[model samples]
Target: MEVVQTIAELRARIKTYRRNNDQTVGFVPTMGFLHDGHASLLQKARSQSGLVVLSIFVNPLQFGPGEDFERYPRNEEQDLAVAEAAGVDIVFMPSVDEMYPTPTRTTVSVSEVTTRLCGASRPGHFDGVATVVSKLFHMVQPDQAFFGLKDAQQVAVIEQMVQDLNLPVEIVPCPTLREKDGLAMSSRNVYLSVEERQQALVLSQSLQQAKTFIDNNVSGSFTSEELQRLVSKHIQTAPLAVIDYVEVLSYPTLEPFEHSHSITTLIVALAVKFGKTRLIDNLILQVRK
Candidate 1:
């Protein structure tokens, strides 16, 4: 309900909350153009903490040169309504100048774990994510933070960063929220034209096909070369969808599994292009013991 624009003002407000014995604060950091997935995170945060702080900053540091930083959607009024509906107490929407008065020299990087999946495609993306998240963590100093599992790799990267850096906050991973047709909700979904949006369903469909392959006791256990092949086949069915990467990785580590039987928890993450809009979706498959 309350919007704070500057870092100092936001910090002062949080300090006041802490001084008043708020005890637990839940933080959800996001770029604007929020959707149900983001609202889901806020709802979870609100349920767990006395004060829920949602920061909406389109962090330039996390974007690559050719990325859609300029066009990344924004609807502050709508986002505030959504946050209030989700029971957020404070919405911290800081300006770029407030977040970075000068060029940042220090960067946070979680090596090895960040070298694959989304990281492989978006070079230095995780470093940017880690840096901004670290700054937010310090500024908010929340007892808990919420992230969507839709950004599974990002979740892994942040969890690793927090552990390595000894940040005193619990990282909560919320389940991915999906549309009725099965596409994972994303802010970028706004970029999709009607036809492209239809085509984008392939990303989720492909993952579901992979899940079916696993459920059927198909040839391969977890690393069914067949599963990968089938997903590719489904994706190719959508001519407009250009495959970025479709992979099955170990859940938390994100290391690829060569054999299906060897995988305990498999993450089927994919990025694809429908027209010029790049969309991502994934399915987490847990192999039964």
Candidate 2:
């Protein structure tokens, strides 16, 4: 796979493939530190598009104050290997200056969807995400873009942004890949200590408990708040897990509803801190009669 750092070179290479209209381009945008989860995205992109492009930029705009920006993991050598193995045709690994040359004056913001969950906690976080992904989407004008469902909110926000902006790209949301032990795969998983890693299983375990509760209550008697509480209580079982938020909201839309009686789809999303490292996980549930 060919690797290019500048947008000009990346575009020049993509243009070669785009000259043939039958060739569809697939794009996966990521912050470095490639993991199995990232690999899953790349694989999906490879399966769908004639050309797969992976861009790794640890966007500083997405990092909030006092967040793990500087200390966030980075290994270009390993990331490139993963990209090449996944059959990525082009890897756009750009420096911060390359992405944002002279301070970004513009921003892309999506409302309502960004007001709750991760968005509520991290102010301007989705703004950074929307902005960076917007920039990348423009740079790599692919037919489709792949994103993992682990960050369901991110997917929703990006989908909304694309729709609102009338961007010509399909957002393909893939399932969240997990470890054998049930811990949802994340680049941040590397930060967990051995013991903390073991305790982290509760995040997934709690989601399972919530799922069971929903399945058992197919009669739609439970309130959204109750489901949130059930998952929150279960995650608390892990001594080291500090709950950020556990929410049950409409899928894709992410707006909270009073009862499960009317909603056909819902998402159980949560964020928890294991020591200094914060991890997020979720499950999309289909409420059935």
What lDDT would candidate 2 get against the real structure? 0.92
Superposed model 2: Cα runs more than 4 Å off: none
What's the TM-score of every candidate structure? 0.97, 0.98
Q: After superposition, which runs of candidate 1 have C-alpha atoms over 4 Å from their true positions? A: 218-224
Roughly what TM-score does model 2 have, to 2 decimal places? 0.98
lDDT of 2 by residue, 20-135 (tens): 76879999999989998999999999988999999999999999999999989999999998998999999999999999899999999999999999999899999999999999
Task: Compute the lDDT of residue 105 as modeled in candidate 2.
Answer: 95
Give lDDT: candidate 2, residue 198: 94
Worst lDDT run of 10 residues, candidate 1, spans 218-227
- Who wins the TM-score comparison? 2
